[model samples]
Structures are given as C-alpha cells and as structure tokens.
Target chain A: MKYKDFNHWELAEDAYFVNWVLRPNKHADKFWKQFLADHPEKSEDVLLAREIVTNIRYSDKPRLNDTEYNDLFERIISTKRSKRPSNVFYVREAQYRWVRYVAAVTLVLASAILYNQYWLSSHPSDEKTIQTLVKESPRGSKLTAVLSDGSKVKLNAGSKITYPKEFSDTLRLIYLTGEAFFEVESDPARPFRVKSDKVNAEVLGTSFNVRAYPDDRKISVAVAEGKVKVTNADQSTVRFEHTLLPFQESEINVQSNQVVKRELQDDMIFAWTNWKLVFKEEPLSLILKKLERWYGVEFELKGAIKTSETYSGSFDNDPLKVVLEVLTSQDAFDYEIQGRKILITSKY
Target chain B: MKVFSESSITSNGELKKTTSSRKLSHQEIVQGLEQGDESVLGYIYHRYVQDMFGFGSQFTRDRELVKDSIHEVFASLIARRQSLEKIRSIKSYLFAAVYHRIIYDIKKNTTFKNKNQKNNYREFNIEFSVQNRLIMEESNREKLNKIKSAIKNIGARQRQAILHYYYDGFVHEEIAMIMGLKNAHSVTKLISRGLKAIRESIAVVVVLFMTDLG
Candidate 1:
C-alpha cells in the first residue's frame, strides 16, 4: 500500500501494532482480538505484519561488547588529557588568554633570541636585567603588555604606558596615561620614573601601581614595596610632592594639582591584576564602559540617561553577555539587548 | 557452500581480508567505556575490529585500505580520548566513527576517480546474502544469497536503511543519526520505505532466478 493511503494516526497505529501487540501486552492483546473481530478477512495480512514486526524486533545485530567499548573511550580521553596545558588559560587573567599565550610564547621566544643575541654581543648575562614593558589597560579594560625592558606591566582599565626600547644608562623613563601595575627590575643606579598626565611616580627596584586615566580627575599611585616619589608634573616646577611608603597611595587632583595620602589595602588595588573588577558606588556609565572594554564591544545609550545612573557591583572577567544577563537578573533592573547595544532601564 | 565447525564460528575478531568480523553485545561494552577505563577500549577493538574491517573492506577490495581505516579509528580514539565525553551507549558512536573513517579514506585516495563519488560509496555495501553464504546452506542459503543480490538493485539510501536496520541491526535513532535525518520518526519512515523497496526487489529477484529454470 502507498504511504499516503495512511494518515498520521494510522501510522501511529501501525507502529503500536508492530512494537507493542506482538510482545503481548494487555493493551496489545485487547487490540489484536478486537482487530481480528473487526476485520476477519484481513487476518492474514495482520499476521504477516506481526511476523514482520517480530523479525524486525528480534534480528541479531552486531555491537561492541562492554569491555571493548570502555577501552576505546578510556584511551581517547587519556590522550586528550595528556595534551591539555597546565596553566589555567584564563584569557582575561593576564591578557586575552590564548592570544596572550601565543603572544607571550612568541614574545618570550623572540625575546630569548634577542637576549641571546645581546648576550653574545655583550658577553654578559647577569649585567643586564630584562623586563617586559606592558601598556596600561584602557578605561574599562584590564590588560598586561610586556615592556621592552623585561619589566612586566599590568594595565588596569582606562590606563596607558609608554617605555623606551632600552633604558638609558642614567635613567629609566615611562609615560603613563591611566592605571598600571609595574614589577621593576632592581637597578638603584637607574631610577625609573612613570609620568602620567598630572602625576609623576619615581621608583627603584619595586612593585607599585599608578592610576591616571585622562578622563578621570584623580591620579593615584599605590606602592606595594620599597618607596616612590609622587609629584605634580604639570606645575612649572614640582608644586607638590609625597614620599609614599609600602601600603600607602598618593592621589593627585589633575585640575587643582592638590595631593592627598591614604593608607592602602593591597587586595583592593591589586585585585585588577588578578582578573577582578571592584567598584564602590561607581557610576552606571563608567560600569558600562568597563563592560564594553572587557567584552571588546561597543555600548550606546540615550545621552540624558548615561550620566544620571550610578551602580555598585563587582565582577570577575566574564563574557559581556553573561555578565549583563546576570546583572539584569538582579531586582530593580530591566534591560534588553538589540544586537550589540544594551538598553538599560530601572525596574522600579 | 563452505562447511565450518563450531570452532570456526569465533567471536567477532580481526580477519585478514574477504570476511566480516562477528557482531558482539554492544550494551555492556558501552557501559564499561563510560567508567573511565581503558580495558574497555581494547575489548571493543578486539570484538568490533573484524566486523568494522569487513564492512570497511566492502568499500574497497584492497585489504590494506580496510586495515588502515580501521586502525585510524583506534588511533583517533587514542588521540582524542580526553575530548570524548563518556558515552552511555557506544554502538552509535563506534559505527558512526567507522563509517566516517571509511568515507574519509575514500575521499583521500586519488585513484577512485569517478563521477558522483558519494553515489558510488553509497552503492557499495556488505549485503546480507553474500555475507550469509559462508555460514548457511540449502534453501536457506539460496534465500539469503537471493536477498543480498536483490538488495544491490535498490536505490542507494533505501538499501542502506534496509541493510542497516535488518542486517546491521541499527535502531531508528542510530540510523537517523548515521543517515543525517532530523529525527527518529524520519528514520522510521525512511526505513519502512526502504523495506518496501527491498521486498519489491526480493520479488523481482525470485521471479528472475526461478524463471531461468523453466
């Protein structure tokens, strides 16, 4: 019979007959007896159908035994595990993880060759300290860029730094635009200076952080080890100076050239280096900027609402959509996304 | 027909060429594999390697081609073991892997220069009758052989669905996945259609083979 002669319900009946009735279920027995009573002349066709059903059901097909199946799976998994990288490839932890891996590996390899070249030419390994000079993170980004000097720099969002290919014999100089963390190689002979738009921080063989985003009015420098000189560089002469000790930060107001000192919490300032974004009553507009930078996307809003809303929340490095979705899940907020733009409105 | 003792009816294990390895119980093997044990892998290889090799060999008469393809599946399992999720049922996965490897091998070899390579590949299948001839005799043997020859004349996909469902013993879900159908229901329809086609082919083969005697 043609397939079209049967409807979907009939097809279902055919399935029910083939699978259930032959096996002798209560329903199947009732259906089979009723089927015969209803159409006695077609009993042979039904019996043939039953036989076909049983044949289809009971046919001995080949398959892998348990022991063999397990062994195959085990071997495949073990090999894959062996190939996994040891370090958590946290893309946002240091820089974009995979890119940073390739970039770091390439940079290390390239630098290693260059270091070897330098060593062969100079014939001294210990004389020169190699460091990676990294630029500061942008306004809403936390990133690490290797400096040419082998001094590692971790840039917080809304930060930038510029350093020389090689530090001069007399001085190590770097220009900064925003926030950054620096691990400087010990060289008391050559003092290292980071020049921001308003604040200048000088250090020798120490780790410290500087925040001097151009858009922000404050230039803050926090010292973790040793000491640093925070000075107002915009003045014709050094108008203000603060000698900052460990666990101390100096904030310089760019507009007024005024300076303030505050005792530091190491975890709070260094948190960005560890892939955390901390906020204390931060403006909603500022948080949006950070989200956009973190996810490498752009956000647009109506001008009037951008400056009016303020938010307080902390986040780790996560996908922008995931972060936004989580944020929207909170009470008193409703938001919708159209393509890349997130339209935020308060629920209350 | 060839005669064989009980000893010759060995479990599905490796063969040199020209024969298929026997099918084994798939359920237990799959359960063992999901438990993170390597022993199961070896057992599966031993059990299915011959049958998989036999099925693979039908695509090409060359013994090395079948062996190489079978070996590749094992090697791939080893290399990608970590990535593979612990499977609850391995029958679908194993057959799918073997079938894919066969297709890959066919594509890689430049010698099989032909138009509609996919159609050619689909047309090549290890049918039931030819396979049963080695183990059966008399009227039963004739039925099996006639069925196999009849299967060759059917449309490629229909033949595949029929042979897989009837001979290889794949379920609708497995067959659908292998044939790239959207769901099991589609597979059921396809299979019923295929069986009807096979039945027609069986009628034609019976009439043709029987008429020759007259």
Candidate 2:
C-alpha cells in the first residue's frame, strides 16, 4: 500500500513507519528515501511522524543500579564457574549437587576470613607495634614516603601505608590498603614484602604497583621493573602464587580463587603514576569503580549498560564532570552530579 | 522496531559504536562465554540485565523473584553457550528466555493463598510524555493529554506489544517470541489494533473539543 496518502498521525501509528522512524536499517532507509523522492509533498508528514515517534518517552522501568548489576553479574559468573568442565570430577549428577553445596559452604567461610583479615589489617590495633609509622593520603590527594631502607612508596588517594620506622635486617615489610606504587631498593640479603588484605607481593629490588582496595573483589599487582612474586594470603588452605617480571601483571579474584596473569603494556600498568587514568577498553562498571577510588566519589548507574559495552580513554586530573561527559558522549546515557555523588541513567 | 544503527552521532558528536564492535560480535561473545571469559560474561550482564529485570517484573511484583530469574537465565546461558546455535537477535532471545524463566518460577511457587493474588498484578502500562517544548505549547496541551489518556486506555497486551516494538526495539517476530504469540503476523495485528484504539479515542476527544469551541 502507498504510504503517500497517510496523515502524520496515521504514519506515526503504523508499526512499520514507527520502526523506520526510530531505527532505519539499510533497507528501511532505501525505501523511505525512494518514497520521499516519489512524493516530495509528503516529506513534512513523514518528518512530523518521525518526530512524534522519536520523542514519545515511555515510563521508566525499574532498573538495577551499577552496584547491583555488578553484584548479580558476579553471582552469575561464579555460578558458571561451579559448573565448569574441569570440575567434572564430580561427574555423577547427584555428586555434583553435593560438591556445589560443599563449595558454597567453603566459599562462605573463606570470604568471612578474608573480611575479618581486611578489617583487622585496616584497623590495626595500637598495641601491636610502637615503632611502626603509618602514612595516609586522604581523598583527592596522593602521599609519598621514603622508608629507612631507601625504598620510595607513592600512595594513591584514600590509601594508607603502615611500616616500621627502621627495617629489620631480616626483612622489610609494609602493609597497604587501597593502591600504592613502590620502588624498592635492591637488597638481595633482605627481600621486601608488601602485604594487602588478599595478596602479598615480595621483591628483592623491583618497582611495582599493588591495588587491593578493601571493597574491590580482586587484587592486582603490576610489575614495572625486576621480578616480583605475588601470593594469595587468604586464610584458605589452597593457596595461589604467581611470579611477575617487568611488564607483567597478575590479578587474583578473592572470592573465586581465580588468578589471571597477563603481559602488561606500559600505558596499561603505569599510567596512574603519571596522574593519568587510562582504561584500555574496560567495562563501564570497572571504570566506575576506578573513578570512585581515584576521586573518592559515589557513582550510581540508573539503567542497564550492556555487558559488551566498553570504554577507552585517558583522563589526566580532569574534573569528575568532564570525565563523565566524555565517557557518556558515545553512549546513550546522561549523568548528573550532586555533591560527591554522580547518577547515570539512559537518556530518553 | 529499529535495528541498532551503529553510526548514529552521539551527544559529543562522536560516531556511536556498538558495545560489541568488530572485535566483539555476538558470535564472539557467545564463544567467549563458552570459554568462560569472565569479562565477556560481565559485558553481557551489563547489556541485558536491566531490561530483563524490567520484563520479568511485569509478570510478578516479587522483585527478589525477578532478580533470581534473571540470574538463573544468565547462569543457564553461560552453561549452554557451547551448545547454543548462533543467535540472530541477542536482545530478543534474552527477553524470551527471561520471560519463560519468570513464568516458570511463578508457576512453581503458585499457592492457593496466592492464587487470587495473581489477578492483582498490574497490566503493562506505558506513560507517554512530550518533552519537546514546541509540542508542549498551550495550544497542544489538550491534544497531548488526549494522547496520554488514549495510551493509558489501550489493552494490556496491546500496550505490551507497543512497548516491545518501540521502546525495546524488537521486531514483530521477536515481539511474538517474547509475548508467546502464535506468529509475527499476530504481533503486527495486535499493534495495529492497539494503535487503532488509541486513534479512535483521540478522534472522539478532538470532536468533543471542536464541538465545545463551535
């Protein structure tokens, strides 16, 4: 049927016309282009109908925020892990069910221990050591410290480093929560170890960054020079250990006990040292997490962001609004800032 | 419904690209999922979970149940990723899968005490608003209100059909799959009928307004 005679309202009501207006594929575009050419007088009707279809905003649906989405995604991914082919040792269907139950119990216990350790480490009691010096970088700032051993430590925002004023001849140990870049002096006689809640990185004389924010489920160590050994320090009997040379990084998932080691590009591992935040095709959720840590702001996402969606850009000391505006420019989302909180939602 | 045109100009004047660019297509995502790629799975979750939650919530007001159903759907998709055939419309397939899972869960949890409660579940209702200031002029206020009421008065199934077609950008066949209709033709008919109802209502309102003016 010829669409030329249809009024603007009729065209708007037509499913095909509405589809063309909202999302014109190649075929739809071709057809509409030809139709406009054939009946130039109907262009206004078509445009008006298109405007109506495009502007009609539907009621907002209840959506899971970024935190909720990430939480649910973690659950889904972990559940998948439990059913992996490698776990086929529990081949019998009934036995598989039993193993899952046992695994669930073990997970609960493991996480509880991890949480306890994180709490204790973050709030180390005053009675523990009189000689220890604690340096803290409040939100929106970085702190640098020189240990007695001549090692340099650059603490990220909202991070704290606790170490002894004088290093023992046996070992040089420091505790960190949040993120830090360390340039340890080469002392083969005494290996240096940086401990976080979930993992420990030991080195003889190497520079590396350790990110183990208490709220983050994963701990990452990116080595910049020399060799560093990373080991999962959770109280679980089965431990994970990995060694990283220069230009290597390892991430340990605290909950699933998964370790991922990969080669690191210079920009990927060390950009934050230069006061720049670089994300090489990272998910919006992970990017949000990093932004929260760096800027010490709360981010609340209001709509569904596709799992396949990723963003890649670098920001150097940009305001939170500028960074957000740049990120949301390509995606059909909008962001608003209220004090220290940013709310992001899909734009209608 | 509209196909995802990847070339639309974004707010910042940059060309929009799909989350799944050349490096990550639907097939690759499915393959990654089968290979237990955590990031890929996470990407899929970010993409569809909210819409799935919204659709599932339509069947039941139990928010917990809806969340559970969505979780189960993703878990199952991951488990079966290796066996799944190439998916044509990932969005539609996901919508259908989540819809069926929610219905199954609701049926399994049905009880005599809650049997009547099922009737209390609200039908799908779409709130239409005109945001264009030009259209919001005083002259168009009556017409806008009429359109809004007309939308509100449409049948539940019709409203759902329109929502899936327009807002969700699902094709007629996909809408049919999500709604469990017989075929795509049925979806087309449902939408046309719904629009016709709205048109008739608006016509009546316009006639009454004109008569009052005369």
Compare the candidates by TM-score and give the number of the best one: 2
Candidate 2 displacement at residue A330 in angstroms: 38
Per-residue lDDT tens digits of candidate 2, residues A100-119?
11000000111222333443
The per-residue C-alpha lDDT of model 2 at residue A45 equals 82
Residue-wise C-alpha lDDT for candidate 1, range A1-348, written one tens digit per residue = 232344322332364554554345887788667756876665655654444433332122233442223323333333333333334433222221111110000000000012233323332443356342445454445676655445567776655565556676766777665556665644566776766445567766554566554455555666654467777654443377788765677765555555678876534555455455555456666766657655546665542454434555555454566566655564356667777676766554
Badly placed stretches (over 4 Å) of model 2 are A13-16, A84-348, B1-23, B116-122, B130-146, B208-214
> What value does the lDDT take at residue A56 in candidate 1?
32
Query: What is the Cα-based lDDT of residue A297 in candidate 1?
Result: 61
Runs of candidate 1 exceeding 4 Å displacement? A1-143, A157-159, A236-238, A302-311, A346-348, B1-214
Interface RMSD of each: 24.4, 13.7
TM, chain A, every candidate: 0.54, 0.60
Candidate 1 docking classification: incorrect
